[model samples]
Target: MVRREHEGSVLEAGQALRRGEVTSVELAERALAVADELGVYITRFPEHALASARRADREFAAGVDRGPLQGIPLGVKDLIAVAEAPTTAQSTVLDWGQGIDAAVTTRVKEAGGVIVGKTSTMEFGCGVPDRAKPFPIPRNPWDTERWAGGSSSGTASGIAAGMFFAGLGSDTAGSIRMPAAFCGVTGLMPTYGRVSGAGCVPLAHTLDRIGPLARTARDCAALLEVIAEVPFVAPEFTGDLTGLRVGVVREHHFPEDADPALAGVFDETLSLAEGLGATLIEVTLPYWKELTTAVLVTASCEALAHHRAELITRWPDFGVSARGIFAAGALVSGADYVQAQRVRQVVRQELARLFDDVDVIASPVASIGAPLLDDVADEAGQQNAEVFEKITTPYWNGVGNPVLAVPMGKTGDGLPLSLQLAGRLFDEATVLRAGDALQAAR
Candidate 1:
């Protein structure tokens, strides 16, 4: 039951399940035993998970296998519907979903992934924690008082704390990658529209992408393969970045107030990429500011469209952080939204041209590590959240490209630093392969 054996292990759980070294129920129990301590689960389905694991064990005994996720204990984000639990999306506003599974949930069950339970998320996937509400505040496993990046909060924290091997996380503007980065796990934000969003609470319909967060890139690929309905197996790649062209971007990600240790850790990662035989070249992302702006404006407006009535009728029911964001949508003009879309197209086209020169682009996922919990829940903290989206996640989300987040190194105080690898649209294979190569070098 050592977490290290499964942390970076790709289908090692599945392998053990098939070899009779362990039954699915044991893995489920191991995940369940440590679940409550990390503030990871919004709902715990102990009996249901054991039932699913028993079925998986029976299938394995019959010499039948679903895929990489078979017999693997996985978590579904609270925002996604599960027949075993209500869809909370970490809010008191809406909790009516029941008796049916979300599309991704059905996919997970079909692949024989044992659903441990629903993991926590921010309010409707757009807010930070609010103590005024009645939900659990997700704490980082590395340091409980430190923030475990938002919207997709508990899934990443749970993975880092060994609650579950991997899980589904939705990213509209960095929910998946941000938490993954802070928690020091690997999170994949697949190309938009690549995975269906049905039955999951919508944040920004056009921007929302359902993807996997796991301990490693290989594990993310395995989960994504089932949810995305595409083949993601890479061929014998490890510490071999030969002939790989990587664009190193530092234009916006390296902010002025960045942690002093950030430069050193990020530079070491680039050196490792070079040591592994990849060519690194300096490059600037086109329309970085405009695209980031588009993301904020688009997310707020779209989210507002969904929650405007509730924001009016049940004003205080929404979290303080969620209200501030959803209210901003009221300030945007129709022309402004149109302009954002136009700029999105421009960035997408320009990035497409940029991708022709480099096989993948790389950067530090954040200029600093996780902020302290109290600091992240205050007014200044909200501004920090804006800076976070602008610098790290929005640009890629705006352009509809697949991005992979991996632990690069640690800050002086031992917080995890993350590296992101972005690929061409629908070209997750390249990024996952590169991310795996980077992680293998560790």
Candidate 2:
């Protein structure tokens, strides 16, 4: 039995596999063991995973390596369909028979990645922690008592806990970045439409993006190389941010009541970026608050549209938190939806203008670290977690831009704080380059 801690980034694992240091079967078994212990998986397909691993091992032995993800064991959020596994979306309302491989799942499999199982998520990718639901709540690996952010909950917690090297997560209103921030892992939400959302459940058609969460920006780059629709060449890590222009949006992102520890860490990270020769300039986003409001309205209305029939017929089956959120969408007037779209267009144009002046926009991923499970167990906690603690993520979602959340430093309690880098549309390479530089510096 080879130890699992030896496993790290997908690149490192690929190198080790090529060197005969580890087998795909060993990695899959280790991942299953850890996932079972942590309750990170909503479903486990040990047999199917081992079968895939054995095939990956054969391919590697035959010198037919697919890529960095070849032989890597990865998790998929439950909302995404994987052949033969139930796409429960961590809700009782979904039809299990509708499960089919999502486009991203097909890509991962084609790249020789082993599908471990479906991971837990917030019900339909919206809602507070609901103990009433018949699914596991993903706890932050940093502190089991703290809640992992969702609806990419299990993917983030699983990666942070070393259950797998990387996993697919959908970001709409910070599902990927928030959990990645809370769990102390790196997550990327590519520009909307860069990756297909087909076969995966949708929260908001316009806001949803499929991307990877992993240990490092390079690993995410590797994953994106496989899954992205257009050709994406990852930038080389130059170990310094020379010639990079980073716009720091401190005024809007950092509220006056934000944690002093988080602010101090963010300031230190900015200094580090400056030391790397990157020019840092403070920039105020136009109508930042209104843009954020546009995200809420658009996402809520879209979600309501998707679940209207279900909410009408299966109200009891849905989690209370999800039901309330989706139901609130019904109250949104057509005029309000159209007005929100206008705001979105305006915000997008403003961001485009802002990006014309800077290579990337930087902000804190969240205002605070992960809150305790007990603190976010109900509606009040959900409000605190979604609205107060998280401010910057949804704004990017509204503008439909690529954002990468990378760990900057830890809180006084050892929880992770992250920095978000937003890039021009379809310019994920720049955001990732900045993230890679920061991670290397750390």
Candidate 3:
């Protein structure tokens, strides 16, 4: 029998399963109970989940193990296709029939990960929270009134609330990391092309990448090892960064008017790393504003292109926030799109040069803790959120590098603060190593 307080890490759950201390059915039931109370899932398939768990139990009894993920319960963001439920993307505009099992879904299923259900998300993976929509507005688990940084809102919130061990999330421009930071969970955005995007709804074709959100960096590594198309090796956390070189990008990354509390927490994190035997060096990023502008233009154009027909034919069906965001993409002319790509090229080149001098670059994920939902619920609040949410995550998305967002500290009101560590292209091992070390130290 699984205890009621069995909110263990992914590895701990796996160990318990191996030792016959608990069954996957018990874990799924526990997660479903939490999801029901927190409104974390957009769609729930309790019957199907229990059936899958039973099968996993039979496999373990037969001495046939899939891997670490065997019998683990996980949720799929609504944008990602799962065989058990429809992909709503939290929008009435999407065709329910279009949701099919995506590549990541198949991988998780094959690895014996029980699919709990489809979680909520921003409509089409962009836009602010809209209560007018049919879906539930995902709230931060910590306060219940604050925003869970999105567009990967549900996945991060669910993980933080212990709805499941981990879940799939997509990041086009800080979707995964932002929500994780706001919800006090860990999120990883793997290098572009590292994971297959087939079967997931497109927010921005060129910019979108799928990854995991969990309670710890090690849990993320386990999920990544199972789902990543490219071969991955989990980094060993030695609790000591003896030979690591971390580049601290503070000037352009954190604005002068940034939250003092967040900055203080970041400074403390740097000191912690130094105490662990890592050398911290100050560095400046070039074309920071240009890179950010390029991300907006590129993402807007791509998103608009993908939904042009829908926007033209059935515009009113979309949530007001999503409709407005998609409509803006129409203003991006062909030349503007091409020029944004050129800017991206230059930014990527500059980041490559910077990485030559540091093993990984560390920066604040956002300028402040999660804002109150009331502060960003309306059009004016949404606009303020767009300006006030000064995030450095999108820069790495444009540069096509792997980034890990780890919980660094909390604000006075008790909301979580996060730090992002970015590494060379396809070097998620080093990035995860750094994140793991930080978690171990904490």
Clash totals for all models, in order? 0, 0, 0
Clashing pairs in 1: none
For model 3, residues 1-442, the per-residue Cα lDDT tens digits are 1123645788889999999999999989888886354457898879988988999999999998999888888988999988777788898888563446899988998999988888888889987788777888888888888888788888888878878888999999999999999998899999999999999999989999999988888899999999899888888767788878899988765676566688789999999999988899898877888888898889988889899999889988888878777778888899998999999999888888888889999998998788877776465424354444576677777888999999999988788899999999999988888888888888
Deviation from native of the Cα of residue 81 in model 3, angstroms: 0.4
Output the worst ten-in-a-row residue range by lDDT, candidate 1.
Answer: 1-10
- 1-442 in candidate 2: lDDT tens per residue? 1124634898898898999998999999988777355447888889989999999999988889798888899999988889968798888898663447889888999999998988888888976678877888778777888888877998988888888889999999999999999888899999888898888998999999999999999999999999888668888878778989999987766776666698889989999999998999889887887988888899889999999998889889988888888888888999999999999999888888998899998999888888887777555434454444454678888888899999999888888899999999999999999999889998
Error of 3 at 94 (Å): 0.6
Clashing pairs in 2: none
Candidate 2, residue 198: CA error in Å?
0.6
lDDT of model 3 at position 142: 81
Whole-structure CA lDDT of model 1: 0.86
Cα-lDDT of candidate 2:
0.86
